[model samples]
Target: MTDQTDGGRRLSTQEAARVLGVKPATVYAYVSRGQLTSRRDPAGRGSSFDAAEVADLARRSRREAAAPAGGELSVRTALTLIEPDRYYLRGVDAVALASRYRYEEVAEWLWTGKLAPGAVFTAPPEALAAAGRAVAALPEHSGPIDRLRVAVAAAAVADPLRFDLSEEAVLGSARCLIPTLVGALPEKAAPSWPGDGRISRRLWSRLTAREPDPDALAVLDLALSLLVDHDLAASTLAVRVAASARAHPYAAVSAGLGALEGPLHGAAGRLAHRMLREVLEQGSAAPVVAEYLRAGRRVPGLGHRLYRAEDPRATALFARLEELPHAAPALTAAREVATTMARQRDLHPNVDLALAVLTVSSDMPPESGETIFAISRTAGWIAHALEEYQAPPLRMRPTGHYEGPTPPQPLP
Candidate 1:
């Protein structure tokens, strides 16, 4: 039940309790509140998630993932989303919001749970340093998301206050790490957080040296808002598991960060990027898609686990990109490729694919896109962590097989 969860370590309910310094029953509360994620094993029993992501969530929320409550603690849950579910930001669908608002405004809506009618951004020391580290650590050939994975992992290690889960530090990491990572990914020199203003409280603020074009910023904000939450992403589940253990926010956030490093979570963006590139190069989506179907592999960046409507974020970005002046040939080419999918195929654009083109067009640094996502997503993770912190820990236990005990009674 140790707190650290790296390289895909999953924890059960009882195990989670040991890490959080609480009983297993409290962990159950976390599950009921949508703070934790789990899966159904073959036996129809649900298994809890890894604790690392929960700890990571704690770090950004300015609170522990799970704290004392009525003499009980949260517990791990065993549930699954057979399909992806629709996500929202500030009560708006991602696509509609992106189309109508600026990135700054959108971020505010997500963080505050209100559509604050103003710009949104953040620029904290941690955000700045972490963003740079993400880009610097990338292999020369890596894409935005891959670099982000490495950067996030490294940032967790580099934080001077890695174990401090105070409100100041957690909020500080949310503001600083996000913007800095966005700025540094483009191979730029070190970035300094803006001294004052609302932007100072934002993760996206410092990522751009100049004032963001209102339109582009709006789109990004919308995208960020949309991506701010999901039912129980693998990494997010990790966040709740840590809360079940009563790990501090930073520790839970570290766990979440580790989960994001896995291919299933953080790497989805890279898949979208690669798929778009392939489609553009082929100059025909049909053959490219056909090939995948032949191999019986599902297409990336096409259908989603949730959302009967095309991903609103994707639609907004694609529509907006279409409107941009003299959009680059690569972007135009990518859109042509995306359109080839059937509308009824229920195939739609997702945030990842749209971001691939948007980041390139923004001329942001190589890994800036993925780094930004980590920064942006921290907000949602933090929110979930805070919710977890209010609950008590839970306990979990299961029977162990003893078939061989009698036969192996001889002492060594």
Candidate 2:
């Protein structure tokens, strides 16, 4: 039933659920997540939602459901599913999984479907040495992604079983290659431990020279677990395409890295970092945001395609950042940016903004978030590659729709 109120027409909980095409429990979940607003009925009947709001939410749901138009390639996998304001990995709540388990443990579960406590990925000495040499060969000015590309190539050459497509062989290679990639990065700080530690611990030294507090280190680890996989993202699709062509796991990861280089795919964190730094320097987000609009640039880190509300990853990371004393200023700046933009449009903060807060507060460089994303997402890429390996080879080819002048009149 709909009731007319001062704000507008309002729908009861059941009506809202029907409009959203979800169960009543899901509607309540949305309300709890701040994805939907609920008001108590004046008659004390039940909770009510704004009719316009429910209609808008229903439209977004429909658009998301029909995103893949005709002829669009869709691959089936038991990996990840992104919904209105939440995502799941292998049927587990990703945020809960990330918060409860270490990054390595979550990654192991994603790869093999079973949790192994205290899971550790150790790189083979030869592969590590090879990757280090290749990374060193790059020009000093090369970015982290460039160095990672070189490292993966060198590691692949060092593995004698690189061509093996067997699940066992691929899994073994993934475990070693991830650690090798992390180990190959040039360390910015002196070693706290003698070369053996979690991937997050080793990566910390490379990202910043500051000694990590337990809370900060925990946040980094949480970030890694949350980012391990995210459906078939653009880079993941690139990885799948390579795997479909029988590319080895290392080569498939390299393809993902190549795709990640695009500005739209992986560079948002750096841009967000710069924006937050400017907000800190200028003491307000209003002028900074105005300048961005004046220059005809879309504000970065404000929205996500997959999420209409707050990004679940951003929500999780922001909650953790709140507990860190050092992160206060950057976190405030992030919120200010979001609030300032919200006055004009109702965009929410995405993971890039949260990552920028972590990097900016931790004294890490702007590109550090991209590096973290690449490293963490390698597990996901490998997992997708594993799935692709089990399917028929060359199944990803799609017929091109050619639209041009008639072919017979090409006598130029």
Candidate 3:
């Protein structure tokens, strides 16, 4: 039962329990745990919950229940910590670090505790040549990620010292492998000169034909720095698992790249890019957002489970994008999408949305954001692999809970 109250519709305890897919006792427990709020009934009935609040709680409950059992394993790490609205890298504010340093400097800091102010990563001639040949052999219809996977594999094969898991050796491989991956991509822009060794500049040439303004390049570099690590994301976990099995750094990174190909992970930004483009062509976000909802598709890049407020990475990127004249239209469209969605639910823009604005305004293809994520996250994957190398081999193996029928009777 529900009552239309001055504040909103109020669901009785029974109704709340039914909505939450739990018993009445669990509903009371939720109120006590502060997961839900309840108010005393006016006519001396039992507690009542706000209808919208119960619905939101129910949604979260369904999502949590859908996740695989025993999937929430926790491991101690000194890398990154995600809070409600902000995240940190080794106890330092990530946004502040990105704002103050280049991507190479930040990556160096993440790898070693020491900061290298003018750090630069350069690909070796042999490894770069091998990766380039491998990437060039792929079909013309292959995507950026396909090229990246092939490049990493070829780079691994080219490195004679790839099996040396010592800290110094692994770091050496990382420094070379990162640049090799960037250098392997076929350049979309005309080669004007021997480029500065900055990873962002080289990656920019591969992403679009248009020359980048200084601010645009700065934003791209910042995006790279900000994305360096996010504390045991799915791909990072994959890297760790591979590393736990004593896989070499290159193989560990390959594991991460494989996991990143999933749509729910690295490909999110591409979806957001397409949606923003649609909003631009349609002249408003309403119709585009409405069509998405009508078709039972999520309006991507709006919410993140780790954040209740704005995603800090998104906030930082959006701030930088506002100063770029070319980004104004895409930025406005992003804001419109967020605002329109906000009217229904309090979802905020995530980093993917900000990345979409960058990709859309810069005349890059939809897959550019994923490529950036893959390249930037290589640093983090290598860091995790290095950490895992120090732990006991095969430490990530977990016992599975068996739920099969009686084995003896199934022999037929």
lDDT of 2 by residue, 124-214 (tens): 9999999999999889999999999999999999999999988889999999999999999999998666543789998999999999988
Count of backbone clashes for each model?
69, 0, 0
| lDDT of the structure predicted as candidate 2 | 0.91
Model 1 RMSD in Å is 13.0
Residue 89 alpha-carbon offset, candidate 2, angstroms: 0.7
For 40-89, candidate 1 gives per-residue lDDT tens digits of 44454455666675555334232322342353333332211123444455
Which candidate do you rate higher for TM-score, 1 or 2? 2
Better of 1 and 2 by lDDT: 2
TM-score per candidate: 0.60, 0.83, 0.82
Error of 2 at 44 (Å): 69
Clashing residue pairs for model 2: none
Instruction: Flag regions of model 2 displaced more than 4 Å.
Output: 1-69, 194-196
Reference-based lDDT, each prediction: 0.57, 0.91, 0.91
**Model 1, clash count?**
69
Residue-wise lDDT of candidate 3 within 270-385, one digit each (tens)? 99999999999999999999999999999999999999988999999999999999999999999999999999898999999999999999999999999999999999999888
